[model samples]
Each structure stands twice: as C-alpha cells, then as structure tokens.
Target: MHMSPVRDDFRRSQLAIAALFFLLGFQYATWVSRIPALKARLDLGEAQIGLLLMTCGVGAAVSFPLVAVLMRRFGSRLLSVISALALGVVLVALSVVPDYPLTLLVLFCDGVAVGCLNVAMNAQGAALEARYARTTMSRLHATFSAGSLLAALLASGVTAFTGTLAVHFGLAAALLAVLVVVARPGLLTDDAPAAAQDGPDQEQDGPDQEQDGPDQEQAPAAKKDRRRFALPAAATLWMGLAMVFGTVTEGAMNDWSALYLKDVVNAGAGLAPLGIAVVSVMMVLARIFADGWRTRFGDGRIVRTGSLLAGAGLALALLVGGVVPTLIGFACVGLGVAAVTPCVYVAAARQGSDALSLVAAMGTTGLLAGPAVIGFIADATSLVWGMAAVAVSAAVVSLCATRIGWPAPEPHPEPHPEPHPEPLDGRLAPDAG
Candidate 1:
C-alpha cells in the first residue's frame, strides 16, 4: 500500500517516540542491574532496601496528579524533553551518591522525573498512534523492552570491566541526554489531527443522530468537550486499575529479578542478570508480534491470555525454585505481560491525552509500588514468598482483564447544511416534505 504524507509524518513521529521509550527503559535497567552492587555498598537489609525502592514510587505517585496539569500547560513534547533530562541527571547522581540517605533522596527525585517521563512519553506515543489512526502501542512498548534488554547486557559487560556503577551510569546518562536532544524535533504536540478526530466520531455518531435529533446529539458533545481535560470517567478508572495489576508484575521483575537470582538461586554475578535477560527478551519477543496478535485476536483476548500466562509462569518458577526453572518461569511471565500495558495505553490514547495521562499515572503507581511490596514481604517471610507477589499481581490482572474496556467514542460536530431559498411568496418553505 502507498503511504500518504500524513502517515509518513506520523511514522517519523513514531520513531522519535519509540526512541524515547527505549531510552527510558535503558535508564531504568541500568539502575536495576546495578542494584546488587548498590545493596552491598549500603549493606541494607531486605526491608530497608524495599523501603528505599519504595521511595521511587512515592515520588512518582506524588507527581502523577500534577502530570495532567503540566501536560495541559506545557504540552507533552516539551515535558518529554525536560523530564528526560531530569531523569538522566538523577541517574548520574545515583551512580555516585556516597551515603544511603542521599541515595534515597536521589532516588525519590529520580522517581519524580520518571513519573513525568512515563506519563509524557506514553501520552506522546498515544497521540502519535491516534494521529496515525491505528494501533502502535505494542510496537512502541516493544522498543522499550528491547532497550531494557540491551541495557541489561551492556550493564553486565560494563560491570565486568569497570566494576563500578558511576562509570556505567555516567556514560549511559550522557548518551541518553545527547540522543534525546537530537530526537526532540520529531516529538508530537497534538493528540490527533482535526480531520482524524472528526472522522471516527462522525461514523459512530451517525446512528445516535438518527435515533435522536441533531440538537439532542450536540448537547452531550458540548458537555463532553467541556470536561475533556478534567477527571477521567469510570471506564478510564478501570483501565488504570488494570494497568496497576500488570505494572506490579512487570515492576517486580525489573527491580528484583537479578537480586533474587543472586541471593536465592546462588547464581553468580554474570548469571544472575541472565534471569532478567530471559524475561526481558521474552517480553520483547512477545511485544514484537503483539500488534499482529491484537489485529487477529483483539485487545481483550490478548490481555486475558497474557495475564494467565504471566501468573502461571511466575507460579511455576517460584514452585520449581532454581536458576533454570526460575528463568523459564520468568520467561513465561514476560510473555504473559508483554501485551497488557500497550493495549491499555492504546485504549486510553484513543480517548484523548487527558485520559492517557490519568490512566498512565494509575498504571505507573502499580509498577513503582511492586518492588516495595516485594521487599516488605521478603523481610517478613522470604524472598521467594516476596517474589510470589508477582504471581498474585498477574492473577489480579487476569481477573481485571475484562475491565480494560474501550473508551467512549468522542462525538463529531454535525456538518451545517446549506441554507435553502424560500418560494416567491416567502410563506411556504422549499421542499415542503
């Protein structure tokens, strides 16, 4: 099929947005891969470490509500640039922090930046997808996983060579900053074009107008437009909850998988990260084809299946309790969650950027909260049981899968009809029917 100029513009925008996703993942994994080293340096216990990790989420949660206001005022494109810069700076600070409290402070700040970056970038991605008039969320998320996988591999190699987080993270921070600067030109400013916005609403609104007159059709549209940037409705809330469940599973694996393997499975430094790599690769692989699966099976089925797989996979790994079995289990977990977030994000984007930010924030809380939950559990019982939280999260997502419902389609403005001339008598209207 021949591509139009508009599609090509969106395609470029998509690439730019995908680059941002990749960088975000890369930054996150770089820090996560170095957690073992940081843990040893601080000599913190499981509970302390968990609480420390929770600070990131706390910061993010605090910032979530503000994202909508920020986006509304400054626009997502600008926020993406500023938040990414903040993220890079915080990451560099994390690498060199001397004390635990300072590290906590830095991580809290990192979480704030991350909160902005997460909502902004995803909102931008959703906007681009809306402009393109198709499903691009999975592919964008796949790029993120790909970045995380690459970063994990690089961190492993860098740790082997430099044996320091400062050098590894410093270089990564510099690279991301430069790349984002270069890609800033391609980021999108608008959620959707006027033409694209009106088209779908027009088609969907046709039947409603036929049932009710144009005046009735327009009242709801005007009301909806007035509230467009306000609070999300019930459906958006449900979507956000679904995001929380999926993110809990994903966040747990990202933050704790390597540490878990090293402490629990007795895997060596080199091998421990490999467990996370298995999950990362599986998630990347699953997402690579998620758009296609979505095309064939639809969002509901993909989410339901992915949720089941994630839960079952984690349970299997936790039950088997070894390096190899755990790896296999995490791999299953990865595949299961690959499609869930992307689908949810896409659904929210279809609504509008406001809805996207609200849902994204809700979902992000789940991701950031997972590590803290696991840490507390591990401190109380064991890391194995703590890790079991991922399985539980997966189960929650499976149950909530049906709640990831589509957004209410926006109403289109009815085209004004041309005026008809009256008859010569000026009393009887033309076309008296």
Candidate 2:
C-alpha cells in the first residue's frame, strides 16, 4: 500500500504534462472553431483557404526535422514552455492579421509551435510513463480531448454572443500563456535519451572504476549506444506512417468538421459547431478509457479496434449526410481515432528519445496535410467526399496497426550495488560474504 517517492514524482509529472496537453487542445480548438469566421473575413474560396492552411504544413515540415536536434540542445522541457508561449502569441496574431499573406505567415509560425509542442510534450509524457512503468500517455491525451470539447462548446456560445475571433482568442491566449508558465516547473527537465545514456555510462564505470580508469574504459559501449540512438529508419517509418493516418483523421475533424456540418449537413449557425463538439466529446470519453484498454489489449489491438470504429463512424456520416446522422458519425469517428496517436507515441518513446522525436515529426505531416487534402477534394467533388478522407485514413490506420508491432513495455533497470574494496593483504575474498 506504500508508494515510493519516484512514484509520487511521476504522478505529479503526469498531472503537469496532462495540463500542457489540455492547454494545447484548448488553443487548437479555439482556432479551429473560428476558421469559419476567418474564411468569411478574408472572402476566400475553399481551395484558396485550404492552400493557405497548408502553410502550417510547410512550417511543420521545416520544424519536424529539427525536433531531435533542438530537444537535445535545449531540452524538451524548456522548448515546450517556450513554444507554448510562442503558440499563444501566434494564436493572437492569427486573430488580427489583416491580409491573407500575413495570415499564412502567422499560421506557419503557429505550425512550428505546434510541431515543437508535439515533440516536447510527448517526450515529457513518454518519460513520465516510463518512470511510472505503466500506460499513461492515453489518459494525458484524453485531457487534450476534454480541453478541445470545452473550447468548442465555449466558442459556440461566445460566437453567438460576440461574433469575433480576436476577443475570444486574445483572452484564451493570455490565460493559456499564464498556465504554461505556471506548469513549466513540473515537466521532466532532462531528455529521456539522456537518462537512458546515464544508465549505461554508470553501469560501464563502476565505483571502483571511477577512481583511476581512463575514459576509454567505456568507449566501446558508449559508441554502441550512440549508434543505437541513431534514428531507426524502419521503426520510424512504420510508426510515422501510422501517426500520419491517425493525424489525417484528426486534422480533418479539426479543420473541416464545422464546415462540413454547415455546408453539407445544412446545420444552422448555432448548431454548426455541434458536430465537432460531439466528436471532441466522444474522443474525450474514448481516451479516458483508452489507458485501461491499452493495458488489457496492448497498443496494436486497441488501435486496430479504434481505427475500425472511426472508419465506420465516418462512413456513416458520409452516407447519412443529414445533421443528425452526421453528428452520430463524427462522434463515432472521434471514439475510433482517440487511441491511435497516444498508443503510437508510447510505442515510439520506448525506442528512445531519438525515435520519439522522429516518429512525432513524421506523424505531424498528417496535421499539415489533412486540411489541404480535404479542401482539394471538396473543391473537386463535394465536401461530403472530402469528409470521406477521414474514413479512408481511419481504414489505413486499421491496416497499419498490425505492422506497428506493439512490443512489450521495456523493463526498468535496477540500481547496481557498490563493489566492495579488496583487502590490502590480497587474500582471496569469500565468495558468499
């Protein structure tokens, strides 16, 4: 019945990390809820808007390649705080940017912030989960869904009253920035890879070896570990692909769900955001339950089940097209896609910091591509078909789940005992002393 101090630290860290996730979701959902307003303010066509939205992807592509390097040099904890603050600033700027080009620039910067937060926060989550020796990432992610759900519902009410993005966004930004600053202390300060490195280094250099041994005593093992830390191309690619599929579904919901409801389902302004909110609500509920499911079923099975659920849900929405059925569909999709990214990140983290960063960067492409792809499809065919992309991506995720090969969680390493001193007389030591 007694918990160790390490468990306590991990528990506190989990709450802190979950707060960051919630803040992130709140920020993102606020922006998404206002996209319809921004689209109207700029007087842009669907294709043009989608193209501009792709600027975020451009920023993500630029930033993703740098996550590992930046995380190593600055540490994920610091980077997360810095980036969250920057993202808040960017969100505010997005509200008031006068022209489309400026909006693109601001959005690109927002994308950079998004990419950094993804890497940094996931690093923190993975570290905490590793420390606790259990599945925690999904629950942290569920907090994000809770934030998004709240934001959407709040935006719906606020827009009905005020009809302005700037006021809503500015208030949220100020509050979110303050929360990020307050939460900064609780994040894991050191890189998980660095912690992994420390273990091997201490093992190679015993208490006795520390006094007179040359640094080269551990050179071979250090060199091998360095090699292991190199990005594993195969693992990174598969995990990234899985993330891409999951994120595509997520991105579609974030960027297009409201529009889909408004344009295709013919929902009224008051009801337009309801579908998206329903999605968020279902996602929140699913993620809340995902940790237990992950433990009982493992990542692959859980993700596969979720993906199938999401696909069926989207397919229902596409076929039904009416407001009622669409809401039901989105809710189903939300439940289905909830578990994919959390499980993927947890799996990636087990590989090490390098793999975590690489997989996160790779997965971020879906966030960038999802809106743009949907926009293009909507332009060419119809919003209904564009919505089909969510179903398709969900199906792809289901297919990729088995290939993810969810390995068992890595075992925690035990501390080594100090070596006893040799007697000055040089007699043989007792074997069972």
Alpha-carbon RMSD to native, per candidate = 9.5, 8.2
Question: Model 2 over residues 1-433: C-alpha lDDT tens digits?
Answer: 8866656666778888988898888988888788888999988789878776677767866685566567766777888898889879987898889998888888888878887888789878866655444678889988886778788898888888898888888888987888887787788865543433332233443453466574654565445545645636465567778898898898889789999888887889999988778887788788888877776766778888889988988897788678888888888888888889998886666555566776777677777777778899989998888888779889999887766647452243221122111220011111110
Candidate 1's displacement at residue 40, Å, is 8.2
Candidate 2, 358: how far from true, in Å?
3.3
In candidate 2, residue 96 scores what lDDT?
87
Candidate 2 off by > 4 Å:
1-7, 31-52, 92-102, 149-170, 194-232, 253-275, 312-330, 374-389, 409-433
Candidate 1 versus the native: TM-score? 0.72
Model 2: which ten-residue window has the lowest total lDDT? 424-433
lDDT tens digits by residue: candidate 1, 59-176 = 8877755776676567778989998988889878987789999999998888888878887788777665444434577889888877887899998889888877789988889989
lDDT of 1: 0.74
